[model samples]
Target: MLSDPKSRFKPTSTAVADKSNILSALKQPYSNAARIAGTMRNAYLTNGSVSKVIDYYQSHPTYNYNIYPVLGNKQYELNDNVRNSYIDIAYYLRDLNIKFFAPIFFKETLIDGVTFWYKYQDKDGVGYMKLPMEWCLIRGTENGVYRYMFDITKLNDETVQSMPEEFQNAYKEYQSNNTSDTNTWYNNKYYYVQENGMAFTFDYNSLVNGGLAISPFASALTDIISLAKAKDNVNIKDNLDATRILQQKLPMDKKDGEMLISAKEAMIYDQTIRGRLPEGVILATTPTELENIPLTNSGTANAFDTVNKGLEQVFFSMGGSSPLFGGSTTSSNIVKEGIKKDANWIYANLFPMLENYYNSEIATVKTKDKLLWNIKFIRQSNFTLHDDIMNLKDQLTLGGSRTDYLAANGFIPAEIISKLTFEQQALDIDSLMVVKPTSNTLSAKDAEIQKRGRPKTDNPSDDTDRLDDEQG
Candidate 1:
């Protein structure tokens, strides 16, 4: 899951805090089976079966889409009860003999490395992990096949104790009843994974790509709670430490000098001026052209440097320089504006019931798998206010200092180009409901580690030829 503390895609500070809080809160034992059944009963009964349960989810604010049925990836609030309810339903599915994911589930056991769970309802509709939000967004697999098949690995907890004996025996009984070799990701750990039937080779890095930002705010909140109660192992400190950095690669050149007249003319000729250079054409004279330099490695999944810069402009255009940092008066003002804007959104207005739904509906008053639960919900939506806050946080802090987007001049590959449509298309409801961990009331060690400064780099390599190669 993206919630893994060791996630390669380290979430922003807010996300980190949110995840940590959820984990802290969920540390106690929970009744997974019972909780799921309660949600299923309500989701199915009040909403009328699985289909309507999905409908109920779509209509909520946190889940609402500027474009209905097309849910944006982001977080929705979940109290302890809400998460427990979700677990109950998934476990119910496992018990019903309607075997769709057992193969993936069982195979992951061999590796014990998979952080696996299945989401029945997505912001858009069903099967977000496998399905694309839109028909056109489908890649790597065929379209419309997301409902039935799955690409999954098992999750083993080594830091935590292993499953109890009774649970293991029950699982064995189920496996014995269903005996078949299906190709799966863990079939060999080398390639194919097999369990009940389904199988496939595993590509760990690509599969566990970007999705949603989990909240570390809850972690901070928990630290406050733990501190009042006295804690030692947990840390709620927040800063740039703990090594959860989000590095994006973008196509940009250092802005040491003017853009090449040839490249600038290329853009101008492409549309604006639509003609050849008169005759005095000196490539260095063009002001808009960008040099071919690696601006930054993309951090925002499909975003390239040029596109990221454009996004940077739009975000800053929202009266911000980068993502928000809520300590100073300046940060407070921006946070207020961002929060207001997020709350007053068109989509946010339409489906204002999302938070309550998670609280009152999805998360059924239990903390079972709370961390995983939050990560799953956040990952399911894209059009969310959470993105808005995240974008703000990016601008105000380290994001403001990042040099990734400075040198880009608009060249983007076809694949990443599609995702760029997020610019002003519509507000993703998920962003508004999703909150990053920003509570300062906690005294957590993780937060303290984050507050620590860099130990300093002592690189001895000198690049005296930098000026000559800069082409300034």
Candidate 2:
């Protein structure tokens, strides 16, 4: 009975089922099982589930608009918790880069191995400015080949008009080609110019996204920032709801009674006396009474603390210590150490990447025979002045020359050190020089006598001599 295709299998005293029959039912040539399996396989192969998810994320209209305006354009803005994180990181990175590797123009010949360094300057005397790495958008494939780079340039009407004709034309052409696109460079929008006028669209040997470079925080930042914003919204709504609850009045007494005043009269009474009640005014009320509302004291158990934890997570994800975003004036030793660790990590990883990108751009402008010099980024140490001073003292004590020690400690510029040495020598000579009083030098008494014409008398008294000196 079980083997029969028309029979439905059921547990009974006489019922029996075998593996062979079950297998036959499942694998039958014309059975519905094969059709169901084939359908699932086709769906998997076609990525039907994945496509639906992606479509929901990409095609949804609500996701396309910015929810917050104060933070800037929603597409480019981060959540409040991590909103300023990128800006802070970018600022530090840009400052460090500028401090260490403000571009220097150099020419090198391959044959003689001779190199000449020149201060970087534009022919127009506007000064050669290196674009900050933080302001650039790097996009590339998975193979470390940079495909497209965008330099974020803020141009106003006057500045745009003042730009060179070649740059203006190129910018206008770009705008004309991309007018329909939201990312176009019209008006105050960002403009993308070719690096050093090179036609090559891709940069080679870039570690992130083929050749396009990006902030270290770019990958994990968006989700964390969004989560933080969501938390803040939830917190605000919760607090508002709690406040509303607190504002509601509770019934103190229950009595079925008709009001002495009509609805219109009550409205008039409220409008007149709601916020303008005079002191000591009393109204007789026996049947109807209203109770004062009490505030609700719902404990905010760890809600804000959770938000803080999320912020810490964001900072950590961005290669920063939690204390950096803790908004505290002071931190513990552990936090300081964590910050130092993060700094070292950035120096080792981020600075080198940026340096390499700049070097690649620099190479493009160099002639074939001119050896390209890679710019070096100096990572500023967190050592305090005390540390440097102590180190300087130690070096001096260890027989290091004063000039070398001072130079190594960066106490004075090399050019000014010579002048300082000359001044020190002059001061030493002045200190060493001393004139001995000669026997012919006039005494105070003799000088007074000479000034007062040898006093009034030959036997001048002590008081008379002093008075004469004073008079003289």
Candidate 3:
């Protein structure tokens, strides 16, 4: 809302928790990553700005008419751009470092969609959903495309047991699980058999109109993220009140319930804890004493204010000496095409806040919450945004325009291209053991089990199907 142009103040907070992100969930069952990837891809293809190859087919009249026979979805025939839409999403995600899984959808909590299939003999419909002769993408990149095979068979001995229940059911209903036909090939190690190697082919799109293709979408990402979080709250809210939500969900074995410092959250928390520190930690405390500057021991407001005043003068001196905002901020500018209000606000608000932040951060390096947590927080910059929302100011606007001084790092999603003056480089496994253990030795096991991989079963073919789908 801060970026609404009409909105007057900036947003600020250190409330971020990495409840769900790309790598963490994907490390579970391949299905989890695949499902999330599908959502991301679906959003990418369905988005209006992606300039993928699909747009070509979708734009054409003749090619648009050639689909009903292949997939049976009337929408495919009318949509024309089906293939392009799928792959373009793949391309866009590749840039964000998204990993892809295909063909077999392993069952796990990592994904957000359901398992759907047809062709079943069930009076109760539950087992029917597991049958695969008739299959639905249920989730992943396809927008509404479901594929079904009729009169499926089954394979024999080892192969039958090797398949995921979902895939095996589909195979049995299609052709009685019979892969005696040489068409059987190794997807990874498991045997995914079709009378003729007619496996499903999935693709990735790395770039779109030339920006990051986020799954939840940057604009409405909170909604998707909220759904993901609501799932987490389901497990967490039962024990604690609203105030202790973060603490209860985190690793409290330390000084009680505490999360590993979020470098970002720590930045702001340090500011708060700094007030509780002693006088020596403030005027007399040296960087060497930072370790001793925790909320366990803090200074008074008078001491904190004293330090803030001195620190502010120094930061401003440096900012004043560095440079001014005189460069062109239009699209024609190589680095920054157009300057944004938020970007400009950064120079005015956040930068100034940094002066105070530096002192606050340094003073409470050893403090609780923000200091020891590593949660990066922007102290009150130009605006007094509350302590509930995250806010980042645009510092670099290259190919775009430096002129767009955004108050919030809203463009973090846009993957604003830049010549990073520096080259670079999640979750605490300690806190996430639900069905598993939570103590020391158990925590170790939890680490291994939850270690984050493309959850594959005893069967390796899930890996192989992935390879085939990617290669195809």
Candidate No. with top TM-score: 2
Error of 3 at 443 (Å): 89
Residue 319, candidate 1: Cα error in Å is 15
Per-residue alpha-carbon lDDT of candidate 3 for residues 211-297, written as tens digits (9 for 90 to 100): 111221222222334434444444343322222111112222355544565646655565665666654344221212123223321
Question: What range of 10 consecutive residues in model 3 has the weakest lDDT sum?
Answer: 60-69
RMSD of 2: 25.4
- Sort the predicted structures by TM-score, highest score first: 2, 1, 3
Clash count of each predicted structure: 93, 6, 81
For each candidate, the alpha-carbon lDDT, in order, equals 0.28, 0.36, 0.29
lDDT for each residue of candidate 2 in 393-467, tens digit (9 for 90 to 100): 686877844643443344222223344656577577555655433324435566454554344455657667434
Off by over 4 Å in 1: 1-61, 65-185, 188-326, 330-333, 340-472
Cα deviation of 35 in candidate 2 (Å)?
Answer: 45
Clashes of 1: 93
How close is each model in CA RMSD to the real structure? 31.4, 25.4, 35.0
Candidate with better TM-score, 2 vs 3? 2
**TM-scores, one per candidate:** 0.18, 0.39, 0.18
**How many steric overlaps does candidate 2 have?**
6
Using lDDT as the measure, name the better of candidate 2 and candidate 3: 2
